[model samples]
Target chain A: MTRDAIILAAIAGAGLLTVLLFAAGADGAPRAIAALLFLLIGPGLACVRLLRLDDPLTELALAVAVSLALETIVATALLATGSWSAGAALAALVAITLAAVAAGFARARGAGSPRA
Target chain B: MAAGVPGPARESAGQAVSSSPGPAALAMAWPVGRAPSWLLTLAPLLAALALWLAAIPAIDPDQMTDLGLIAVLPPAFYLALGLLILGFCALLGRERAGDWEPGAYIAAWIVILHGTPAIVYGSLRYAWAWKHVGIVDYIQRTGGIDPAIGYLPIYHNWPGFFGAAALLTEAAGLADALPLATWSPPFFELLFAAALLLVLRAVTGDRRLAWLGVWFFTLTNWVGQDYFSPQAITYALYLAAIGLCLWAFPARMPLAASPVGRVVIRGALLRRLAADFDRRAEWAGAASSALPDLSTVQRRGLLAMTLALLASIAVSHQLTPIVTILALFALVLLGQCRAWGLPLVMLLFTAGWMATGASSFAAEGIREVLSTLGRANENIDSNLIDASLFTPGFRIVSNAARALTAGVGLLATLGWLRRFHDGYLDLPLTLLWLAPVALLGMSSYGGEILFRVYFFALPAMAFFLAALFAPRSWRRGAASLIVVALASVVLAAGFLVAYYGHERSNYFRPGEIAAADYLARNAPAGSLIVEGSPNYPSRYHRYEQFVYVPLVAWPRGNVEASANAYSLADIEQMMADRHYAAAYLIITESQKVEMSVPGLASLEAIQGEIEASGDFAVLFRNDAATIYGLAGRQGAEP
Candidate 1:
């Protein structure tokens, strides 16, 4: 139950913070943090979690590597398909990040015995 | 153990140990015990983080040994590294945190250690990034390619990295890639760590060894290739490819004696080589029995995914694709795997891209690369001897870099000899280590091929160096782990003696940036833009709007634009030329920094010389930089 709450809260917090970053006309520090979270870390962790490696370090490393490659792949695909407007690119990344996180949560839950 | 098995069988988790020496022998390596408290172990790490964060605010870029030299990053910077080393050893002192624990812990330490210099000194260090950012800006605005650019025109050919950055910057609502450039060294260094760890884990099959390898790499890397450039991205991709190959394929060659009849070669040398290969092939076949059991479909999937990665690498950088090709070929030649198709595929992608897309560099025929071979000795000499010509203080720093290189070279050699005696040097991976050295013969790369060679060989070199601490047996105890930490910290200390020691040239003052920004706003399209030299962040945004010409392309052989001894008459003559647009000259902090070195002309002297002649007027001037307009040009008055 505690684990589930933490996960849910984290998801909510990150999502809310991202929205705030976009909506609040916030410029410097908050925006930089958001970039780190949304652009690099959160999505990276999400991908890493899905790999299901016994070694968390390997998974984390692999995830970071995958995240970079994913960026290149997603950006390339979008550019190849069209002009790749800012909105479209953001949407694609957000969707990918959210989906990966969701999938990772599911995998983590399945791996663990649910108490609640 | 067949740990590389796909998801279904991977749950077995390394239980299928075959011919890996007996457990009786391996059991002696580590003491059986619970790990020490995480909180207690990590206290030093916490302290190190605090030291780093505090050091950032305390840093005054001007206070270095020489002005702006990295030696002045504050005492806390070095303290943080020392704390990391001690903290990490404490973390590994107990044996309970699982295989990834040390990996995770060391990774954090890497972040702190590598990130400090970048943070303390703001903006990207390499002037090359300014040009790179400029190229991306051009691509963003033009939405098309123009391979006619004078410098690094090949970057125009492979536009994937720039195109990706363009999209990200636009989507993220950032001004430009400057932020990315400033933050990239630490970020990319971390990524390189991950990639190195992955590759080490795949090859060594021992997590402790892998962790040690990652630590060694973090300590020894001074090449500064971790800048915001395609090479950094390409390097990570190359590592991933090697890692993935080792993971999926797992090196299972056919036995030389049983299945295939030896084809008789006519020549004596050929026969001897074939016989030697046969014996190694037999040993490799025995080793192959330990490989993972992958379904053909899964193998195919891995192959396809890996090929896509290769294609991406080929599309991104100029030299990495060729290195990837050589490394892949080396893997096969060492009887590590039978992925003969991989090198061929990479070659095709590399050649096709160069021939059709990278035609700017490729216009002279592949002969350009081929002709440059057999000059490795010259490249090395110039790189080591000539490039070290800097200020006295900075020379001490540069020599420390050479010392660090020599030290690591010694450690790796000792490790190799030790592992070779034990008959466990990991030949396929060693081949990967040797393969990038082939690049040394290919290009001088402006007398920096030695640095490039060191960068290329770094990942593989780290793995070998790790063996010095790695036990003959796989199991590791607190004692061995302590030694490993000591090795990393010692090497890291050596690295610190010089790594950011060139901070003077690397740091860009806000004044320089502001001057560049002024030119960006004021310079007309196709204006003949001249600089003190090709350094600092000037054409970053309006890269396409100007024709860049530099005052000094020194170091003996660069084409001089002014055509005279850097004189006022030369400046007047250049300004008088009826080119498409008028000429403007910029002098930034970089040129001022470069003046401390031998060959680069003194920017201060140039400023006085031009002002004394009254042939040029200050169109723009700032605290750290200045822009000059030729006094007698048409409409020259700003």
Candidate 2:
């Protein structure tokens, strides 16, 4: 594959992974493994992608996404532990999702593109 | 430079890269000749003066004189002192080119100067309320009022001092009292605008950009609403410190003068060495020889100015520590001081003098700080995390949409940062500029109180964004679109949220004016009252001046354990002991509602006693508040 294709594929994969991790955690089917998967997959993939991205906008987006995902996952886990309520968990999920998607769009628009 | 390519080729290349207009284009596109400079400066002040004058018909002249003196004097004195200091600075640096345009600077100064009254007023109101709201409760619990008002009273209750001083100075002379508190909102707003201009000027070294910053800070609805609070006063001080630090200690230049000459010379040289030892002193002997000695009066004037600035920080403690922290960080980042000795010494001095009171005050709120921090962390965690790689289609789409919206603000901020750097603005200074964004995002308080703290940061934020998006070329249509887009988002989020969600809420407005008017008109002669709601009492009446009880029983007689709650019982006892006529209970929608406390049943038991007493009557009830008056209570005539 060409470099552009490779970059696009990576972006797609990262985006897909983010969605999957969130979906799994939100399902609340298996507590431990789902939480573990969320901790490892959602933020971990975003972090790795952010560090590896060559483009500034892409990197910023990934960073924001990772931050949001981490916040959501921890909040959900805490809620499941009875530290927080379900309403709070839902609000966190919504806010995080919003922040992540916004970051992604900003990145795609090349808002913080690194100047040569 | 290469010879110009074919026009179409160049044009196509530009179009290919990006369609958006740059910062230069945006600056030029704004209407330049909107309001005359003098009119802009005097408009708010004159309006406030007019309002005060208008109030004279309603208020006694003695009260008016006291209010006018208290509200107007400090700010006027401060502005005059500021001018004198500026003049002295100019005398000291005669050789320096008058690089700054007088018109722009004066315009900016006028905008800032007009805000002094507003800052003083809001701060005074907040401070007075802080002391008065729960005073009766303290009297009940501690057997006397805490003279300190919980924290450093000097800085916190500055308005009271102004008011008292004014009254004392006038010796009960009847003069028309201006509604100084009412004027506070617009005055500080003007200052917030001026500070933005100063920041932009410091960053871009362009008067036009400075003007743009002013326009953006003032004209933008989101920023304008935020500036109308005591927080603006703190912000103005922080910006002033930034300006002073920037002007006093600029970037170090290579010195043409010998090391001896550089050492002998002070001011900028000391700052450069303090900032970065590696910096070469670039003083030309010709310039040095041409400079004249500043007069003793001028030197004294400079000293006075410095003292006054330091005193201003002491007078307002809310943002002083934050300002100090930012200044320290900027100085450290600039690599001015090789050793930590000077910083340590300065820190010691501040801690001993200016910051000591603030440190103690913040310390008192340590429990609150910790709880707030914990809640903030929980909020961040819950709101930011998600589990699935893919969500329900609608959920996924919505999340993406919201994220995109949030990203616009972030992008605007980032874009501003880039432009600030490009304009040769200092990086450390920019970090200080960005401090408010972080503060706003981090603060756990979900009210105007937190927003007030965040207000100081808006000037920097607006100026940075304005400078950041300024068009580099004449073609500004595209840039104007971007500005509109970003501004709309900011307005929708900041102003709409504040207005619709918070300001309109019963908790914020609380119908203070109406409540005050009600008590003034209807309450019987010499009525003894206890205001049930802490928020209500703080808003409507001065608790310190009166003997009002601040506690009340709810529908089922639920008792609140807060300090204000205890005041109700104290007021009842005081009424019985002092042979007062009746008790007045002022309840707002926010206060009458049930909260999440478990041990409220005991407090509820008191409702039977309150109702059983034949003395009480439901005196007033409206959508905003319900006032209960004990029957046969004689109200005091004001």
TM-score for all models, in order of appearance: 0.81, 0.46
Evaluated on the second chain alone, the candidates' TM-scores are 0.85, 0.52
Clashing pairs in 1: none
User: What is residue B64's positional error in candidate 1, in angstroms?
Assistant: 2.3
What are the per-residue Cα lDDT tens digits for candidate 2 across B463-552? 555545544431223444355345534433333222212111112223543665577455554465565443342422333333454464
Residue-level lDDT tens digits of model 1 in B193-233: 88777677666545555677887888888766777788888
TM-score for chain B in model 2:
0.52
The clash count for each model shown is 0, 68
**How much of the true A–B contact set does each candidate keep?**
0.30, 0.00
lDDT of 1 at B318: 73
The CA lDDT of each predicted structure is 0.64, 0.37
